[model samples]
Target: MHPKKVQKLIYFVFCCLFTLPVLAQNRVVTGRVTDAKDNSPLIGVSVVAAGSATGTATDVSGNYRITVPASATSVVFTYIGYTRKQVTITGTTLNVTMDAAGTALNEVLVVGYGTVRKKDATGAVQKVNAADFVQGVTTNPLQQLQGKASGVTIATTSGDPNSSPTVRIRGTVSLSGNSDPLYVIDGVVGADIRSVSPNDIASFDVLKDASASAIYGSRAAGGVILVTTKTGKAGTPQITFDAYTAAESPLHLLDFADRTQYLQAYQQFYGKPMPAGTSTTSDQGANTNWFKLITHTGISHNESMGISGGNEKGHYRGSATITISKEMCAHLS
Candidate 1:
């Protein structure tokens, strides 16, 4: 054998040794997600192979690609507002359409110490989230859970921006101490609801009956409000920005009288003469809309920024938010 030929064959053998392992790990799965009802592409659907730790999420166009272990037998897909779907592995490409789980019986609910399926909970607990929150510009988290939760009453005695709403569970338990439900935000025993941003909340659960509230012991006589925040997962870095702008006019603007209407009403009843130089135009002078004068459009601007990322070792997430609101009422003093 020639030395030059032997060296060429050795180089070829080295290349084949390294390429075999790379080709063995080339098992890939690709798919698209869509809405079951409309056939619309669904983005951000989480896809994970059952027997493997590797996972991936769909893109904006509802396309997903993930690498699975050779021994994997199934894949599971999940989204926040959709039903979970698991399919047996038979081929390389698997497309899925998720149905809207409006009445989510299998949905998970947080209880005293842990979580349970919504249908499995034996206690009287009502859950509220962004989808079911009371529609309004609410500075307090309790406002979102108001009226939706039976036996739960909320009262805002003072219109203070920083003031927390007084929550009473099934009315007052006792005449003393002004019955207020125990506040538990992100597992903090006595956390204040005012400190938590409404947009950052993932779930607001009310434990109304004894079965659910018993976990808190005697302190839960008035019931309990369990608040859970969002969490991070192992995935690519995700950043979110949210801006809220609210324009509010008086709710009962027509219920009150305008400047001209007020003048006429006074002249009709008491027969009082009109004040001199009281101009009469809708936009100017005395004819101004009294409702608009005493109350302007309430405007508030909110901004929030959050970032999350993680790996197999651990996950992390953090966010910050700022809100500025202008009072609509004018000082009469």
Candidate 2:
């Protein structure tokens, strides 16, 4: 072919390459984060692109907006005290609901060294699901158990995150010996439930009877608390992501005594007169709203990503999670 004809062919090829479909790949995803059990909106939750580190947080109304590159395929969602979820984006918005860490309690419970359906349980066992243990943001899993389960009482002697609660089952059966029930995780006896992340748990079972406790022998004298973590199921390789953000504040505040009120009360109770010319009104001190000063609607966020895929030989599933909470106001009125 002539040189001019060859040059024309090269230009045509370049034009074709430039004109070919640009890989239909841009997307924008929007969604709201909510509690799976109650469907309550979770504000300030975090949402992110898996493996890319790109992310955004929910607003006060549980709404979130994110723009992903054409190469992006999946997004992860997470919040404190809730299971993380992963989702693939096909449309413009993806509404997500996150189950509380332990809400699956009644669905499954531990029996001896094995597991059984909660409904088929033969002994008197109280089951607490993940939701029962997670409500707002909590660092300690034991705190979530307080007042949530029947026949179980958890008391916090000190307001410390790492401290274990004084757990009692059906009142104190022993006076001097250990009163707390035996904690088991998976098949291991005497396990600390706190060691496992709240988001990692699938369910919790409480064995509370002599017949139920007999299997473990002496270890079950105080009853038993069983914990089960999440696992993979039979299927093709799949990815799931869940994220959420929430703004938390004190539920209520107490009334405070003003300077005048304090001085009058002090004078009446202690028989001490007010200092000369020290007008209570003059030194009323700034009307400090202690509650407002100590409380804040800080943002709490969480994200979880999981991948599962295998063949007939075997299966595998791996998951990772991240949770973050902004500093909160600690003072009440």
lDDT on C-alpha atoms for all candidate structures = 0.83, 0.76
TM-score to true structure, per model: 0.55, 0.51
Candidate 1 per-residue lDDT, tens place, 188-263, comes to 9978788887767787889988899898998888889999887787899899998888876667756666676788
Q: What TM-score does prediction 2 earn?
A: 0.51
Per-residue lDDT value at 94 in model 1: 94
lDDT of 1: 0.83
Q: Positional deviation of 12 in candidate 1, in angstroms?
A: 69
Query: What's the C-alpha lDDT at position 208 in model 2?
Result: 84
Worst 10 residues of 1 by lDDT: 279-288
Tell me the spans in candidate 2 whose CA falls farther than 4 Å from its real position.
1-110, 113-122, 127-149, 154-166, 175-177, 264-292, 327-333
lDDT per residue (tens digit) for residues 233-283 in model 2: 677678988777877666778888867787788789878797456664655
User: Candidate 1: lDDT of 102?
Assistant: 79
Error of 2 at 2 (Å): 99
